[model samples]
Target chain A: MSGGLAVVGASRRVRAAHYATERPRRPVAALLARRGELAQYDGPRFGEAVFVTLQAIDLTCIRGERMIFSGLTFSVAPGRALLVRGPNGVGKTSLLRLLAGLNAPAVGQVRWAGGSLAGRVSYVGHLDAIKAALTLRENLAFWLAYRGHNRSLAAALDALGIAHLIDMPTRYLSAGQRRRAALAKLLLVDAPVWLLDEPVSSLDGRGIEVFMVALRRHLAEGGVAVLSTHQELAIDEAETLTLGRNP
Target chain B: MMRSLWALLHHDLRISLRQGNASTSVVVFFVLAVTLFPLGVGPEPQVLARIASGVVWAAALLAAMISLDRLFQADFEDGVLEQLCLAPTPLPAAVLAKALAHWLLTGLPLTLIAPVLAMALQMEGAGVVPLILGLALGTPVLSLVGAIGAGLTIGIRRGSVLLSLLVLPLFLPILIFGVGAVEAAINGLSARPHLLILGAMLLAAIVLAPLATAAALRANTE
Candidate 1:
């Protein structure tokens, strides 16, 4: 938790530039993935999210009898984002799931700092996972409690600009509001590697704006993001991985 | 870890209670199914007493089965199971919390209400204590074992039908010992052996079911 809090009222450029200058980057990112997967792997392992890198080395995804994707290679360094792009049924979601460790790669490895993906990734797939019966506050607070985060619940809500909807039940929320709430969880969760499958799928203009703000904030803090989105993201420096185009 | 598990347990109970009330449906099915026994067997007190233990045990097993398919289905569909598996607490411990919550929500209440149902069936007073005690010990095994079935069938379509086929056969030992305990007590014989076996089954389930269910979940999730 070293100076990990987002700088309040600081410009994004100053925040990103100042944070980099304030703390010298260490090669610890090379082993941040393995540190959490120690000899005893089950406990909550909160690694420093800065300077970490996610690597997928020659990964192959086999669903049933078909090889969905193969010989795929990529690495997302800290403070950067990987945009996974492909046509329908082109394995964007499959690749993300493999990286998230939801499905095992038939070959190669999806590693963080060259170690197992355990406890290092926070993944959000299409379903949102929000309880219909619970209020937005209850839903986010549950994830906070699950991660054992001591931060105030309102902090992340305010970041996503959904603080007013905190007490409202999620069942009453529209599809985009639920998606925003799902993105808000990315802030509450302290993981370095975030795997989001089609994150901006149903977000409106305002929801997309706040999401971009939060995503950049996450990147500025030296966290890594691997997201697959149908809409083109406005991130200038982010790398793109086009699946199925590989011969 | 325990705190997170407790949070999950409380979260599950709260959601279940506020929504469609899974446990209530299970209990209602349990009560109605038990009530059918006396009606089918006529109003003869001796006959009802003779069959009450078996009748109640059978109905409890079916009621518990009714709740089993839902144990993981909603969470799996909504993708909550993925987050749950990735949570800081080990998956097996998380499975244990869910299984305990299931028992507490569905099994424990079923146990408490069994005595009243037993009285309606004219179960002998001497057998009543053993009946309640057996249910208290036995119903957890139902929830735990049923969790394994639920986990294995998570993504399968119409899983409830397949869940019953997989779980009912395994439920026989618990049903046998549970009914045997009460029937033995009614027969003026020692129910200790039957009760002890049921307790041992419970201990075994507590240790094994979580690991099995976690593995099933992993296989299904992949």
Candidate 2:
């Protein structure tokens, strides 16, 4: 077990090093020039940050016969988390779907980086969407391949602690294990923002801690996340939006 | 874009293979229905030869329908359909890849087996070539057009029957031309016109069906 852990840790460091060098190097001269003044500014300039500044204004959603929610609004900026809190029927998932562009808002728009949200936004819905017949490795491979990259599959599985179940078919997985695999999907793509609906619903205590750790890393890297949860998240400085039942 | 489509196709084919039953059921249904026709109508060689093309084409059409709902239903229920929508590959192209995989599983198998079934039904030797040609061109259209009905009725319970009701009518032209090609061959006329028309419908379906299905999926999932 210690040997396996060392191998995983070693591979992760190698990949992280590869990412650092392969990525386009930022202008260090400008970084040093702006280092002193960086704290003076509240955030990136309006047009500078492409993935931040997501805003939802007066959004309304209605299902078959019920008005799930109405006149709801919020905003998510870079390095900030928007935690949506509400009761069971308060349309939390629906709102995430709206933001993810799976469903259009009945009344308003979602803006990203001061513009319309136009990129591939990652959404982890209630359903894990893993094929019950395929092994965990195959399931993750499908998403990674479909999204056109395999750079992070091993790392994602390692982070989620499902590296041991890589060869097992999803049908044999417990609910928590399956949820962990689903949460691993959030790391498979290079999505600018994550719309997570009940991201911790089926997770165990340790799974929840792992997810929060990964989410913090995502936010620290300037990605935005809109997560809905029934339990209180331990994320520091995350903004909260509470919704109530419709009239 | 091409990579994404390939990935979608690869994943769908893998699922179909692992599940093992969905595609097998389609083939089994096709074989059983084709075999049952002679029993119902009597095994007289003359009678069997007369209805061979119609029986085989009808059986293939029904077999295609039996599995059409499975194309999107599983993905939709499991939320993978939403992910597909959010994929960088435009939704229509993803739908096309899905339909292509479905045809490979259901349509291609039925086409390959049509000749054997035709032989059992005592179809003329010359008619066998046209039967295979007609089906190869026609069955894909069945999968494609069926995709529309599958998307539209995805949210409804027991939607397979509803899908048949909606799609069987659309299958009429393909069926008419598919069977007509074989009949023309048996009657000593050139089956080219019928085969060509079926090919044309396939071409048009190639362009339109995926687009329409993508729209329906967008609406229904929303």
Candidate 3:
């Protein structure tokens, strides 16, 4: 842990929601679902097998003439989460986008430690990716098919605690509700790595709790997630990375 | 696999269906634009017959162009395009799927309704068959090629005007061949060569436009 984390940790300790005991258990190793045929990107594509760990080594991101962040390094293991905390314009979102493979890093590579699961990253950014004209179920139905291997929407809906909004057109949902709908995608996707940018920004307390449960479920299932937010999520087994000018 | 492509196509169609008025209005614009010709130049059948193919083709071209501005822009704004790019499916395949959706929304309806509009403009007899065939083959190329423009202008402010400027020149080839085929049939000449060129254009657009559109989309997202 770096010095910034200590500062962040001290500040976070004052919050009443911190978990007193973090359950320590070994992370289970299993391939992401839709195995064999569909998960066709499992074998190592680089120097070594890196499927178990997600590592960002000397990563540099530049937007136009400005350097957002550079030489940023972090590695997250299976059944763990990395919380990205920083003030505004600190490249938190840029970092998550890089991890999602949405943008190529200016100088470094985001690699997995066990083996490369090339296409197994789920990214939920600021935009909800919902179709306001369509119902909630309709919006997610497409994702379910795109990811392949049909499963009941109930499980994903239950994960986000939005089962009642299933058939309603998403335009009817409030901002927080819409945010939960986007967060539900983490469950809908069977991918192991999640890159979420400010996922709880619009969520109320209950919505945040809903997100915590879903994220906990994801990490507990041997998945790794990188979440960028201004506030701490108080989830156990999650590491914090603070980006800044003087970190 | 093809499932992802199908899902993209399915999702687009569903969105269009829910926004029922948007898709239908393109066809309505096609109808109204074509109908305006007869009203403008009087009901002189000979004159209407002469310009009928050109007018209908032009209207279909404009209608396709208008609908295209929204094709990728909406998805790009909603973050669906970002999500699609992150998916396992290749970007070119996703572009192909979206182009197909665009064709189904604007091209197919325009093709189906064009003959009625052409006949309404006094374009009777042998010219009608060639017009229908030409449009069926040509309109898909319009959708495919329009995708390139849509992808290019996706993130820019007020990109539709720029989209029109970029695509109108590209659309000239399709218009010339499509209208030529119909005009040839009316003049008792073989329309085969023109329609063949249209088919070739469709095939070429199918191969090249997806790649181009995919590149544009990737660039715009960056």
Considering only chain B, what TM-score does candidate 2 achieve? 0.98
Sorted on DockQ, best first, the list reads 1, 3, 2
In model 1, what is the error at residue A216, expressed in angstroms? 1.2
TM-scores, each model vs. reference: 0.89, 0.88, 0.87
Report the C-alpha displacement of residue B164, candidate 2, in angstroms.
0.7
Task: Look at candidate 3 and give me any clashing residue pairs.
Answer: A49-A114, A49-A115, A50-A112, A50-A113, A50-A114, A50-A115, A51-A114, A51-A115, A52-A114
TM-score, prediction 1? 0.89
Number of the top DockQ candidate: 1
| lDDT over C-alpha atoms for residue A223 of model 3 | 71
| DockQ (Cα-based) for each candidate | 0.74, 0.64, 0.72
User: Worst lDDT window (10 residues) for model 2 chain B?
Assistant: B81-90
Backbone clashes in each candidate structure, one number apiece?
A: 0, 0, 9
- Whole-model lDDT, model 3: 0.82
